[model samples]
Target: MSAEQAESEPQADLPGPPPGPAPPSSAPPSSAPPSPMQRAVQNYLRHVTVERGLSTNTVAAYRRDLALYTLWLAGEGIDDPSGVTGNHVGAFVQHLGTREVEPLKASSIARVLSSVRGWHRFLLEEGQTETDVAHETKPPKLGSRLPKAISIEQVEALLDATRGDEVQQLRDCALLELLYATGARVSEAVNLNVDDVIDQEVVRLLGKGGKQRIVPVGSFARAALDAYLVRARPQLSLRGTATPALFLGLRGQRVSRQNAWLIIRAAAARAGLDIEVSPHTLRHSFATHLLAGGADVRVVQELLGHSSVATTQIYTLVTADTLRDMYTSAHPRAR
Candidate 1:
């Protein structure tokens, strides 16, 4: 039987343990089979996870967004991918806006719509549907916001704050230095192996969609890594089972993205900086500083492992604003 037909068929009841308290009458049975639309969503999720090689967080986001979409489709009595239409997709967008608790922002709504569009496109390409109904459903426009970057002095202070001979402190210092030096996403940095950096001048980073790129290590960061590996990592490694991770938590396993964020925040607090700092803040500062120092945008893009130079060009806006502020303050003008 076809997968959908098999799913629709009622299963043979077998003897089981006595039931507990009855569920509310309004609730559907827990064993209810998934609709055909839901099955398609599962297929698409697997495709992205396995074939597309998207990161865990990215795959989770796609799953969440698509789950909501399928639930909405079921409410509308649309149980098949072929049954969806542009009007249905548009109505779903409207339904999202009408949500009462913690309404989504325009950017968030746009992201949901983007997910929906990708799903429909996938369905069409897979021959599961005749048309991509969501093709014309436009996402809400988002206003441009420049990336936030701290001054060079602020960055130096933050890095300095992580300095100490303690095991965790050595790891933190090296972590922050590598972050500012390489512009790696926190996930990429935390996911690193010891061999990825040890005895190498260039660090290999595995970015989104399993794309790999090499970024050169600066002298300061290299020195920090050498110290951490020599004095700190050996001690940390003995705390738990053996692992090849470059950075380790107190448990001796790989440091997590959350832990890395905490490291950055604690350092920022110690540095007495009033601004919020996260791992991405260092990445932004890295790009901004490079552009401000007259580095070529294309070169920065390569270093950043950005798939397109357009993504790197955003830093130029930050640099331009900085130059404008400097010009207004330094140059004699008839104002």
Candidate 2:
């Protein structure tokens, strides 16, 4: 089936575990014949989007990985998906993991292999192929690296750094506070509406794949947002528009994600934190602080709008690190 048909099919009306995986796809280039790999990948992507209801970004990632796989398969003269064996897939993964062409990180390799496996599963589900050849495949065991998080004191310092005689400074404070308070992704925070931020107690986040989540606002964040909503947002939006954007740029439209990230970086620089700061740093700090105060992981996962509890479990590593540091400082065993 074509990619469009696979995607637009009425799979919702049928009952079964969701479609496994499909081949990756590529955007059709004008005035060129598509190679067999491109055709198969496009078919795969269509299945993913239509049947799986996946986000376009995810589909895009799969497309890139599958493209690389197909290129390697072409080099090996293996054009047929039906003939692509588990050894071939595994070899492809190994080559991707170790190729000197570019220094591919483990995470990148994992992503590529994952796309291949997804495609394998897709074929099996469609009964176009036999068993899932990738069934025994495994992603590289990634070291459990904790997400970067800062302390409450540093956060206070960062917010205080935004204190100045300028409206932009006030806006930055509000943005910083909202990020740390709501544990929101940068895009969600920037796209927020005045209506979306509830009674100053909660903010509605439109997360990945357009999922809506309600997250509680911390005390400090509520106050910061109140001040921004009362003072700075109006000034920023005063030009000629009656925009509903909770945050605005110099143009008074909704702020861009890059600008939001830049705002956090600038604020961190001014505060002399000297650490890599992004909008997610605030989120990491939010989750870590909550967990340190005994917040439930599942509850945090719900608030963060994570589809899986396993994704949220990474923050626990940060909490564990905090405990270890405390133990090293206070425990009186002879060195």
Candidate 3:
């Protein structure tokens, strides 16, 4: 029976789970052109998009990972889904995790292997294949890494470095201040529209998975934004056709992601700070400072638009390590 037909069978009428993994098949690679792997992958992607209702970013990640896996399979002279074996899956895992070609961090490799496992599980559930070739494949364990943050002094220095009467300089200072104040992702910050800031006190942010949250704007950020909108934004807006984006390029277009990165990096350089800085540095500082000041994890999770409180809990570790370092430096006890 076809995989779709097997799926249509009633629960009680279907045969029990196979006693063991499907026996290895010796069928030679078909002489004809291979097509099943690509077809099956497309079908599985559609299933995830329509039935599972995943976000676009997630679906895109899945597509990218599966594309890499398909390339590896083609390289191994296996193109059909049914021809995939446990050994093939194992080798692919090794290929992703090792430095034989381009080395990837453990988290990146883990995500790729996870995508592979999900694809195989979908195939098995759909009855596209009898064996779950990737069921036992394991990704490398990820190490615990603390979020990187700059001190308040550094952030102040960075923002102060951008002072000028020029429209672009005003906008850059406002952007830096808003990022630190709101703890917004770079994407979220760049995506903001004029209406997202309400009453000069709070701003609305759209986050991943299409989630939206409101974060308060501190007095410093509010003042900076006021200056930009009044003194800088109108001049910038005149450069191009009008747009609703809160942050605009010199041409009045919505600020692109790369443009935002350059703004942050330039400001950091002018601040005379030697540390590596990215847009996320401000976000990390926001979260760490909040937690260090006793903000609840759940509150920070909501403000940051994280789907789970567990993701926000990582900042607590940053705070604890800071305390440990302080104790090591200040305590009177002999080493």
Candidate 4:
């Protein structure tokens, strides 16, 4: 074979480049034409972003998976949608997980497989391909993970450690209180508008899929929020253009998720807690504590803005584990 042709062949023995940062999206540029495979990938990326309304981070992940898949296809001399087959997709899955260098974890590979399956479906829907080679492909099974939660005592300690008169401290106190009180996701908490807190009795949260729900705020959360709004927010709100966001950073912009995380971590460190605490840790503690206190699962589900009770059911597992631990330690006959 000519050297050029030889270079084009798939190198099963050669490890591909180590996984790198995700490339710029291949969404069809108005200025530059694309190859057939590139056009299909671009269309799918556009579909996920514009039509599906996936978050920027999620869209970036899809872009990364598809870009890697495209590179693998090029090596295999398969440039068009029609050139793909089930065997080819299966091989790609193996390559993603077992590559000598930079092998992906099973969870990561599962995500890549999900992205590939989505892209293939998009190709079939757009009529770019006659067959869906990924129709039968299955994601690798992932181990079940319980939500990480700090004990109620630890949570109380963390909250106490964050108490202060500084504007940022007040904001952090209120933020943490709301997160635990309402089981709000970090994104949901940060995205709150000034008016979302109603009469300081309850707060309206815009959850995933644009769904809104009203959750009653406990007295502590309500008090903290009232203090922040009256004492601290006005000060923090002075630095940037006025926004409707309930929480503001020092720059007066809405607090980013990273900022919320740092606030929680700082509080955890001040409390001298050993566990890694995140905003979601507060949410978990909220649900688990409510469950342990006899709140209904469905009520917790509504409060947490979960679309399905099945998703909310995981907290039951957490409570059960807690019970088992207590039993093991307290009941001598059980031992």
Candidate 5:
């Protein structure tokens, strides 16, 4: 697929299934030991999970991508790491692109190739392979796409949609408020504990790679949170076992990421928003609105917990576009 096609395609919540037929079923019982290639993949996964401190979702994506790579290797009658060559690696890339059924987009293919490259590098370092054949291989270059963000008015409408006196309503309001206030990923927001926010001006968030960062809470969000904690949470907590989680489900257990998504969707629908609004939309709006208000890009980077300022710079593009639009409409000499 072309880079433009990759940019246009909507990615799944998790990486999609690998190209070609499904990998060998682990369902059937097998007494035989795993192949050398299989063992190498497992070791690499363990390294990433434990040593690298990758998130569970990230490790799962790596597992899916490598499963396809190993299956393709077996199809070519090569089961050992040392037996694979650069030519084989190149051919596998072709295989991913040429598959007729559910062909992967260029971006998806690129992500899978990244998984393959990481595994090969691991093998070379551990002396399981004589050379890193996949080293020279490269993924397709992806086209840059701007993130979508709603206006401040739209965000207010969405937040207002959740306002009510009921326990669920108060909880939903606080959840949405916290998301916008902190620019947190849904996973990070749902993983928060009561102690992370209680009696504090700032909230603590655990981000990718187990990195922690502190972000200040806006008064609007703080008020909503206070209402939930004071009135709603106590009632909800009575339903189930004690836990440190700040957000609770109907059963009083910690809310899940999926549940958080549903809350955002329902609120968006109630607010009559025409555009799609995921948790990431709030994050995008948070960053974009901050930039538009003259906040330093570096400060926004820190607030969002982005390791690289370059990633945070993308929101500036959105603000730039908005500026161009305003200039064209307002300036009489501008054409």
Candidate 6:
């Protein structure tokens, strides 16, 4: 993620930023027929959302990332889906590096590149294009800085900070515990229902790619949910037409993903945590802690509902870090 590597190339067809956010009156030009990449993007977006069953957050990311690719293609005058090449992708990576107007990191570039590759993979499958040029392109070499996971004491402090004798605290406690116990994404957590929590022993999560997995809940998480369901949820629920959602907004409606994130941030802030924490932070910490406690990587992966063990293995990065610390501490020659 070095800035220097990002600043090394200037001669590339750099895509523009997203269509700037504007009021309803300033809608983007739709008068013209869609461009090739635009059409392709629309089709791909539909496939990912409707057929693939990716969550809105994941779909929105594809839109943002793929839009950048489309913009680059438009700028390069490469309208045909059949014309993209490995060189174009490499140039795009360099373009990300050269654009010092705004800071871009190597990790961000890799993510963007990944989206591009995914798009091309789709194209290849559908026969929209014959090339998977993105497949051969190299990602920037990255040393493992490792995923950040706080100590168990920090976790206790984090949850304790959510204390308030009100409906909000109950919701926060449920959300926090569900995240840590089941390792569910914020979207999955918010979309859950009373039925999703099965007798306090396990919860069924609908995860990415429309995959369903049953994950066990710890006693702590179960107790927290029990308290919320008994006290806070009853108070929040209204008479007719109230949602059956396990977690609700102040007015007894199902909470949106954004609101769930807000709840997490508020709790994080209350804990006085200096590092930025998101709902995913809790999930990441959960996976790391579980692995550190000798849970199998595959088991943790299934619990987190990751599509690949490689995604789950990111937690191993934490275990590796702990090993390094042990090495530096215990080995006399190393010191």
Please give the RMSD to the true structure for each candidate, in Å.
9.6, 12.0, 15.3, 11.6, 8.6, 9.6
Q: Candidate 3, residues 107-126: lDDT per residue as tens digits?
A: 99899999999999999998
Cα-lDDT of candidate 5: 0.92
Q: What do the candidate models score in CA lDDT, each in turn?
A: 0.89, 0.82, 0.88, 0.89, 0.92, 0.81
Each model's TM-score, in the order given?
A: 0.88, 0.80, 0.84, 0.85, 0.89, 0.81
The superposed Cα distance between candidate 4 and the true structure at residue 167, in angstroms, equals: 0.8
Kindly report which residue stretches of model 1 are placed more than 4 angstroms away from their true locations once superposed: 1-33, 198-200
Candidate 2, run of 10 with poorest lDDT: 1-10
lDDT of 1 by residue, 20-95 (tens): 9855689655998887887899999989998898888998998889888888888998899999999999988888
Query: Per TM-score, what order, best first?
Result: 5, 1, 4, 3, 6, 2
The C-alpha local distance difference test score for the whole of candidate 2 amounts to 0.82
Which residues of candidate 3, in runs, are more than 4 Å off?
1-34, 47-56
Candidate 4 or 5, higher TM-score?
A: 5
* Candidate 2: tens digits of C-alpha lDDT, residues 48-133: 89877776678888888888888898899987777788898888878876889785778888888889889988888877678888
Model 4 TM: 0.85
Estimate the overall C-alpha local distance difference test score of candidate 3.
Answer: 0.88
lDDT of 5 by residue, 164-264 (tens): 99998999999999999999999999999999984757999999999999999999999999999999999989988999999998777788887788888
Candidate 5 accuracy as TM-score: 0.89
Pairs that clash in candidate 4? none
- How many pairs of residues collide in model 1? 0
